[model samples]
Target: MSAESKPLSGLRVLVPRGGTWGELVSKALREQGASTVIAPLVDFGHTSEEDKLVDALHRLEAGDFQWMTATSATVVDVLAHHQAVIPKHTEVAVVGEATLQAFEAAGYEVARTPQDGDNTTEGLLKVWPEIETDEVLKVLTLRSDVAKPVLTEGLISRGHDVTQVVAFRTVGVPASVHIREDVQSGRINALLIASPAIAREVAKQFPDIPENTIVACVGPHTHEAAIDSGVKHTAEHVESDMKHALIETVESVIDQSDMLD
Candidate 1:
């Protein structure tokens, strides 16, 4: 498509996370005529509880747990790094499309994903009881160091035996000087907030953002987190679509901005 015919033409958008997921989002944005800056705000590292994580993986391979939960793509990366295997008897569950895509890419067969498009822990929990026939199951819930125990706690409250393991620790990455300057000066037209951690990094790195710049968050929870973290956004002026459809969400916001202009 020609630049003038594109919806996001002349717009610059920031993609927070790196690796396979980042590349996919960046490619989608570029196709819509948006120039993307892939400055990853967070990186994953080995968890401090190495022994516990190893034991959990060993038991997972042994098919001790009836179900395994992966909340993020980073969890799938940790599993791939450990060369872990999901036995035939154990079912795999995930929260969002990104996690589902990561599992599929890693050659892991997922047995469950949110069907209602909620794509959050609450969404997964909502369908868990209906999909799972077993009354008492041993669930292995893998999560990041900073992740809340909402899934684990919900499972336990539902009378399931749960073993929650810290898969990896989230580490913050500093943005380059040029990227920081562009953001502060409003050279970048928009910023994408995929997670609360990335939102926190945005707040820490760029304390003062230009009011003209648009900040698009992937979901409702993320939008709340961004505002709570003092990340300036355009939500006040526009009714934005809250979905994990990152490219579509960006286009929706840009369209709103056009109408306002």
Candidate 2:
């Protein structure tokens, strides 16, 4: 390493997930000389309205909707549970490549994937499927329980009939004692806030996070969520994609040795 290298040297960050994902993020941070603390702060739970979602899945298999929107990877798991089938003619709109990968993992094909980075209601709306006829589109939205009805509402305003179903719920998971202690003690230089719920949890659990620790969100929506969650410090958007957002944020803030006076 050059003398001016390792901008993130001495920086310790907290990444919210572990296992393969954690390892991947840790590897990236280690290259930047930042030690990463792997602790997942949230987990996906069953949708609040199981029966409604189950019936929606049945209708999906029956070709009731012309298009179905998958806002997150967890929706793919719901399809797996019901052994859902998508007719060849039915258009499946995925939020992003991650969601597309989830569908493929669950043995489904994606007909349309969001092209933009903000892979949610706004992104899907930008790549809205074309309708050849005057008939209103029949759309099914499978989303998280806490997810706002942005897509459904937007489609409705566009004169489409949408049947929105809750695919899953997000539950908060407590961080390990060592993790919390490190965070509060300000040893952690940054905190990667992946979701709105995670932002809320951080606000609740780690109220005394270091003043200089970076609080970075994946994209604009999550940035808003962090603001809404009332994180005491300013929150910033590091990248549109989750995979590289944390690393990008750390690089932006870390002190560069070459800049030393």
Candidate 3:
């Protein structure tokens, strides 16, 4: 497609949080005629409580838990790295489509995911009772170090026995000097906030965002985080394909700007 036909043409979008996902999103943005700067603002690492993780994984593989829950794809990576196995008897529950895809890619089956537009931790909690329908269930909830205990607490409130484990730690990555300068100087047209952590980093790193610049988030939950972090001019969507949703948000903002011009 020609640049004139592309909605994101002449726009420079910053994609935070690197890895396979970043590369794919960057590639799609390029195809849509947007210049992408892949500056990772957050990353995942090993958790401090290794012994607890090991024991949890052992019990998980031993079929001690009737349901295993994953909130992020990073949790799936951590499980795969430790060669954690989910026995056939134990069902798997996930929050987002990305996490579900990660589990399927890692040879694990997903038993439940939020079908509604809300794909946050609370969304999963909302549908927990309907999914289980039992008096009580043994659930193994895995999450990042910075993740909130909403899922665990919700399951417990529902009369389920839950073991919440910090599968990995979320670490912040500083943007390069050039990237920071471009952002502050308004050279970058928009910023992509993939997670709440990235939103916090963006708010901390660039307190004064340019008036012309836009902030697009992957989902409603991330959008809420961005707004809570004091990010202005932010947009978000709830869709199965997060990349497409973000791209659509950018396109919408650009279209709106064009109309005003």
Best-fitting candidate, scored by lDDT: 1
Give a tens-digit lDDT track for model 3, residues 1-261: 788777677778998855545555677677777889999888887889888999999998888989988777677668778988789999988875556666788788887876556666777667766545766788898887776677788888777888988888877788889999999999997787766788888988888888777677654666778889987663342332434645574433221101110
Q: Residue 231 lDDT in model 1?
A: 91
Ranking by TM-score: 1, 3, 2
Per-residue alpha-carbon lDDT of candidate 2 for residues 135-235, written as tens digits (9 for 90 to 100): 89999988887767777888888888899987878888888888888887888767876667778778888887776667765545566777887776633
Q: Which scores higher on lDDT, 1 or 2?
A: 1
Once fitted onto the true fold, the runs of candidate 2 whose alpha carbons sit more than 4 angstroms away are: 1-10, 17-35, 81-89, 116-120, 132-135, 217-261
TM-score of structure candidate 3: 0.72
TM-score per candidate: 0.78, 0.71, 0.72
Per-candidate clashes come to 0, 0, 0
List candidate 3 stretches off by more than 4 Å: 1-6, 20-33, 125-132, 176-187, 203-212, 216-261
Cα lDDT tens digits for candidate 1, 1-261? 798777667778888877666766777787777889999888898999899999999999998998998777778789889998889889898775567777889887988766655666777787776335557889999988877777888888888889999888888899999999999988987888777778889999988888777777655666677889999765453543222234474433222111110
Note each model's CA RMSD in angstroms: 6.0, 7.7, 7.3
Of models 1 and 3, which has the larger TM-score?
A: 1
Stronger candidate by TM-score (1 vs 2):
1
